[model samples]
Target chain A: MEKKSTEQLEAICSQVRRDILRMVHACQSGHPGASLGCTEFFVALYFDQMTNNPDFNLDGPGEDLFFLSNGHISPVWYSVLARSGYFETSELKTFRKLNSRLQGHPATEEGLPGIRIASGSLGQGLSVGIGAAFAKKINKDDKTVYVLMGDGEQQEGQIWEAALSAPHHKLDNLIATIDLNGQQIDGPTKDIINLGDLKAKWEAFGWEVIVTEHGNDMSGVVKGLEKAKSLLGKGKPVLNLLHTDMGYGVDFMVGTHKWHGVAPNDEQLENALGQLKETLGDY
Target chain B: MENKLDTKYTYTEKKDTRSGFGDGLLEAGRRNENVVALCADLIGSLKMGAFQKEFPERFFQMGISEANMIGAAAGLTIGGKIPFTGTFANFSTGRVYDQIRQSVAYSEKNVKICASHAGLTLGEDGATHQILEDIGMMKMLPNMTVINPCDYNQTKAATIAIAEHEGPVYLRFGRPKWPIFTPENQEFEIGKAWKMIEGTDVTIFATGHLVWEAVEAEAILRAEGISVELINIHTIKPLDTEAILKSVAKTGCAVSAEEHQFNGGLNDSIAQTLIRNQPAPLEFIGVDDSFGESGKPEELLEKYGLNAKNIVEAAKRAISRK
Candidate 1:
């Protein structure tokens, strides 16, 4: 398949944002804040950065694998996975519904094509990524492993344990991206639990840290991911600190912790959809 | 009744169940290329040195991070690698429960959670290190296979057997150097109880180090003309319900024993089975709603009412009640 142009990728990101808003709006109980926040990162990874096939395999051999650590943001992943031919685009309608493969959080028991592990519990995906990266090394596959976590999830002690492990094992084939949106449920992350100088923290933990100022911008995400990929195999894991608004793109929801998990009302949905534009058609 | 009990079961030497795990893990690593091992900084304690030495590439040393070890083990299964995580029973279950629940069991990943130093026999470590509720905690999880092998030989066979079976398994063993009575190369079937002795008076359902105590209790009861049947319940979940019912049907009374607490251990499971199928007089020979203190393994077992004398007393009580 030919590489998708920047404009085409931007169109996909816009559609994913629209899907996130609609899925959460339909359920009336889902996390749209981080889902909307990480729209460009997901689009950029799936559409451009990662080497993957639409023909999904559980054991992702000879391909770059991605794990959603902060799984509350499942809408964006569901949308990107569906839109990228992992499954039918219409399946996005079943988000969080009973008996639907699209669970509230990404799960493998439902046999969803894209998900390999059930991840709603924060601070587990990094260790999982390390294991997959270790598997790649064992198989000599030479492909990379990518994982995304939320900024609030850094408060979990297990994340710090994994933070030490990845570098100790010299997991150079792994790239971890944190959505530094500075917001979590109940309040702002700094108010709930301050993660002081994240870049310095990751650096202290021995990861090659890279920060992207414009996480919502498609071009910025693509470039930042490219830079992360370039720093691979340098005997250290890469941590990309992506600066993003908690509830980006939507006028009312943006820059607040209230919408972290609360779904928008009907009127709010219409308002958010009006801003996002149905570029690739709504699911 | 067709009795499969080994009447002449005996051992000249004793060995810790953890060594059996280490040896069996080495054999498993040799048999399957996909077999991989991970430890949370208890290399010497978990007895993974041989497997690590042989398959250096397959072994991962996850330093003092039980949760990360569990999560990584789940992740390794994504790439079709059978990961066996080793640590103390307390850390394996109580410490990293959410990790195992979400990543491994919930997803039905084929990961082996090999836990050593289980129960009050993790002697001298006190209640904090000794996990008397691990069996209950693990057996409660959906899609989880719980196995608590009795002796060194049985633990070895179980360690190798679980590697062949699919899905998540919690293989619980102890730290004490118990008598090695089970056959060296016996077929260790998951969820199947082994009859160590046969009688019609009372059935003693025992697990882990307590199985040997049950055997001793059988001899003591038999000498007093009170026939006792001993059944070794290795696997706690997907329990051998048929065997239990059949044994209890003949014996008319039952006694359950383990190195764990009575609340959620072998007795609780047996009580459930008996109540559901054939309610009978049952007595428990285990810690009674109490934590264990630091002592020699033998002294602790005796003090906590997990000894052969306690099993014999419970057997008498159960028979009298019947």
Candidate 2:
């Protein structure tokens, strides 16, 4: 797989942001805040970073796997997966609707092609990622396993349980990233429960830590992912602390937790879509 | 030979069901290389040492982190690995209910959740260690198969059998040395009831350690001129409705005995089966909505109304009601 250029990936990111706003607007419910906030990271991961096949196989041998721990942000994932040919982009309209395969949370029960595990519940994906990485090692697949989680979701004790196990078992094939968007549902993560110096915390747990301040930028995400991949196979699991806003690419929704779960109304949706270029054509 | 119930069964030896799990897991590892075991710091308690010894690379020693063990076990299925997680029943279900629900059960992952030291027979470990509500918790899950095999041989056979069974399974066993009555190396069938004795007065539906207690109750009932039909309901979730209805049709009354709580274990399964299909006179022999305490296994069973005396009394009550 050839590495996608920054220009091409950025265009895809704009389309994904548009799709997120539109999908959430259509459903009249969803977490568009984190979905928009993590656009560049998702675009970078699916389009450029992972050696994944959209022609998805449940037992993905010799391929890198990704798990969305912060699964409430399904709009972004559903859009990216659809755009990447995992499914039709038209299915984006069916998201969060009754009897739709695109559930409010990503689930394998509906036989969604890109998803391997159901992950609406937070703090579980890292462990699942570690398990998949362990399986890779056992099967001699020699591929990476990546998990993306929310900053507020770090409050869950199971995250730390997984954090301790990963390095103890020497799962260097595992790469975990926390979307340090600062804002959660109630308020800023610091105001709710301070996640004081996550980099230090991860290092103390025996993980190789990588901090990317430009998590909302395509080039920065791609670079962070590449650096994380480069540091693999060195006897430590990798943790990428990705810093972004609560909502990115839109004017009003950005930098606030108010839009964490509330959908943009029709007028607000038009304003949001106006900011994002329809580079890849709207689904 | 003089009494008919005396010829029903004979015990040559007593062995812990966890040892059967250990032996069967070792055999499962040999049969299929994809089989892997993960334990949360209870290798000896779960009897996972033999499998760990034979296939050291395949076994994962997850140091007291059961949630992570469960999550990882679910992930292992994505890569075509058959993961059997080992722990005490309390930790396996109650401790990590959310983990099992989302990662394994909801996802329909092929992970075998093998739990030991179930029910009141966990003995001196007391109320905290003993789990009575695990069957209720597990059976309620949409894609979970719940099995509580009777004796050592049956537990061993169930262990091997669940490996071939696809999707998630909760195989419950105990810590005590139980009478090995079922045939050695018998092919354990899931969701199918085992008819230990064919009779007409009352049907004794039993599971886990209480299966042995039900056997003893059958003999006593036989001597009292009451014909008791004994059935070992190993699988609890997909309750063997056909066998239950058939037995009830002949017996016209029912008694359910289990080492778990009366509300959610074998009794509930039997009651639900009977009510939906054939509503018979049912009497339950189990701990009636109460927790357990530190005591000898037999003493606890006797104290909690989980022994043959309770079963015999319950059978008589059920028969009298009819």
Candidate 3:
């Protein structure tokens, strides 16, 4: 697949951010801060980097796998899944309501097409990813495995356990991304629990580490991802620390913990939607 | 480190069921390439050392990470591999339940959750370590196959049988050694109960270590002119309802014994079976809804009413109800 230009990738991410705000607003209750924050990175993955068969059946024998360890941001994942043709874009309105396949957290219990495993209780997806990657290696398949974790979720001891296990197995085909968005539901991550020196910590576990600040810039993310993909199949695991502002596009929600879990009321919705273009039209 | 199972189930010295689990795991490594073992520490106790030594590549020491080990085992199963994960019963079921629920049972992964030191047999480990609820906890999984083999031969056979089957299985065993009476190379069948002895007076349904106690109790009862039928229920989930119903029909009374709690454990399954199909006068012999303290295995058994004496008393009580 040919790479998209920086401007085009940014345009797509802009559209995704717009979808996140509108989808959460329509539901009247959902997590939009992390969704809004991780748009560009996911957009780059879906449009530029991830080797996913969009028409995903749960068990893709030779296909690559991407696990959203921080599963509360289901809005962004669902939008990306729909936009990438895992299902119809029309199904986006069933975000959190009854009978909707799109649940509050990513779930396979509802039989959503793209999901392989259910994840909401945090700090365990890396182990799942490593297992998948290990299986692929055993089968001699060349597909890569990717997992994303929230910065706040780094407090979970299981995350480090999975992290240590990943590199110990020389899981060079697995790459984990940490969404270093400085806020969680309770408040800023620093106040709840400070996960100091994440790079040093990951490196200490024998992972080849990379840091990126271009969470909103598609070209930079795509480039970093390319380097990440190139480094795979080596003897060391890769850990990419992605720094991004929470609520990146919506000015009102940006940089504040209030927008993390609080649903935007009618007036607030209008203010938030004013900044984002209706690229693919609101659900 | 201990090679007690090298003989054909005829060892003089007694050993814990944890050692049996380790023995079976070590043998599984030599027999099949697809047989990979994962453990969250406790390698020596689980008796997985030989498997680790023989096929060092296939064994994964998952540290003290029970959740990750379960998830990884689930992932391993996706690639047509038989993964035997060893850990204490408490951590294997409750600590990482969500992980096992999502990654394994829900996904229908063919992983063997081999739990060691199950029930009150973990003795001095106290109530915290004595997971008498593992049988109930594991059977609750929709796709999980729960097995509690009686002794050395049955546990080893069940461990081998799980590899041939293609789904999730929870193999629960204990930390005490009473007797090894099951036949050698009998080809353990999943979900089928074995009738150790046949009689007309009463049926004593037992699993894990109690199978031996039930046998001993049957011998004593026979001397007293009481003809007792003995049934070893190795598989708890997909409970052997056919065998249970047939035996209860002939005897008209039944006794259910296990090293677990009576309410949600093996007794409940037997009660539910009888209530549905073959209702009989029933009395359960087990840890009656209470926590167990750390003690010698024999003392704990006597104190908790999970021994041969309790089985005999329950048999008499059940027959009187009839």
Candidate 4:
């Protein structure tokens, strides 16, 4: 895979954001807000930060791995994975369709190239990442494991359970980032359940914490991820508190939880796509 | 179909099935370096101490969080590691059903969910600890193979055997120091039922702790001139329907026994097999839609109608109905 400049990565982010809106609008029932907001982070990881194989091996023997905890944002991941060459970009049109490799949630049952485990029921991905990291350590694979989780998903007790176990195992090879978009399906996360001081909470759990305010910015996310990589083999797992907006880029949908699950209507789809440039062309 | 009682079943000692799991897990770790063990703070109870001591790097102490253990086990499979998760039946199935369903079974990950202290025989820990409905919960999952080995020897074979077999498996065993009747070196088959005795009067399909009870009932019935054929239906999910149908065809009557709920356990499996293939008179011997309380395992078995006496009565009732 050829290395891309920050400008090229930003271009891919725009195309991914466009793909998210188009895929959601095509299905008429998929998540676009969080997918839109997490575009830059996904772009940065796949395009610039991580050394992964798009050839797609289940075991991922010598390559870095990523697990999506917040499966609702499959649009952004599918787009990024397809754009990054895991599968054909044209296959992205089959999102949530019958007999499609891209299921409503990321699943391995269909034998999807990039997916190693099924994760729709929240708070399990962190543990999975830790397990993968453990496998890497046992096999003497020096590659890292990354997990992306939703902020509202923090309400799940299993997340805390995983949060405690990762550091206890001293999985310094694992890096977890939370999409602190401050919005959930119900409303704002503050209204439903307050996750007070996640940084302090992670620190209290004995993790090396790194907070990045510009989660939607390609350069900032890339820097934060690189810093996280530098902290590995330092005897502690790292947590990146990525502060992203729920519905970013699009003017009307920005900063609202309304688009959390609801797909963009015909007019809204046009309006949303207009904001994100067609840098890599429509799938 | 003849009753192939290959050897006279006998045991001079009583051992807990959990030990078989412990020893088998240790052996499995030795056989396959990919075989790793994870325990959610039940290292002693699940008898994972030996494996932990031997393969320190392979054993993961996942604290008291069963859900995390299950999820982690699923993920371990992606890196070519076969993880065997250990915990109580209650936590292994019911507490982490979602985790097992999505992460392990649904995803088709090769995870051995080795659960100890299953059913009413979990004893004084009471109803909260004993999980009678675990079989039903796991059996309903798409890719889960539910196994309830009757004794120590069988449980040990199962623990080692599941590592060789791919996909997710739910290996159910008990805590009590029960009679060890099965052969020590028996090759544990995942979905094949074992024939303990051959008879014509009735067929007794038993699993987990109740296989020994069926054996004792065979003796009592044999004295009364009633020939009884006992079959151990170890693997409940991919049920050995052919063996069940063949045996029931010869016997004409059947008694289903288990240390689980009468509704979902071996009773349901046998009843379904019989009703679907060869419908026959079947009597159920299990906890009759009730929860177990604080008591010794023997006392609890007798009180809950899971003993030889109950089996005798049920067998007689099943035979009389024919």
- Could you tell me the interface RMSD of model 3? 2.1
Error of 3 at A9 (Å): 2.5
Q: Which residues of candidate 4, in runs, are more than 4 Å off?
A: B1-8
Better of 1 and 4 by DockQ: 4
Regions of candidate 2 where Cα sits further than 4 Å from its true position: B1-7
Chain A only TM-scores, each candidate in turn:
0.98, 0.99, 0.96, 0.99
What does candidate 3's lDDT look like per residue over A2-92, in tens digits? 7677777777776777778778888888888888888988888888787878777565667778888888888899998888779888898
Estimate the overall C-alpha local distance difference test score of candidate 1: 0.91
Candidate 2 docking category? high
Report the Cα lDDT for residue A200, model 3: 96
Q: Give me the candidate number with maximum DockQ.
A: 2
Residue B139, candidate 2: alpha-carbon lDDT? 92
**TM-score of each prediction:** 0.98, 0.99, 0.91, 0.98
- Name the 10 consecutive residues with the lowest summed lDDT in model 1 chain A: A274-283
Write the residue-wise lDDT of candidate 4 on B1-322 in tens digits.
0123222466677899999999999999999999999999999999999999999999999999998999899889989999999999999999999999999988999999999999888889999998888888899899989999989999999999999999999999989998788888889889999998989999999999889888888887888888999999999989999999999899999999988887787789889888988789999998778888878888898888888889999999998899
Give per-residue CA lDDT, model 2, range B100-197, as digits (tens): 99999999999999999998998999999889999989998999999999888998999999999999999999999988888998988899999999
Q: Please, what are the lDDT tens digits per residue for candidate 1 over residues B201-227?
A: 999999999898888778778878898
Q: Model 2 shows how many backbone clashes?
A: 0
Which has the better lDDT: candidate 1, or candidate 4? 1
- Compose the digit string of candidate 1's lDDT tens values, residues A39-100: 99999999999999789998999999999999999999999999999999999898999999
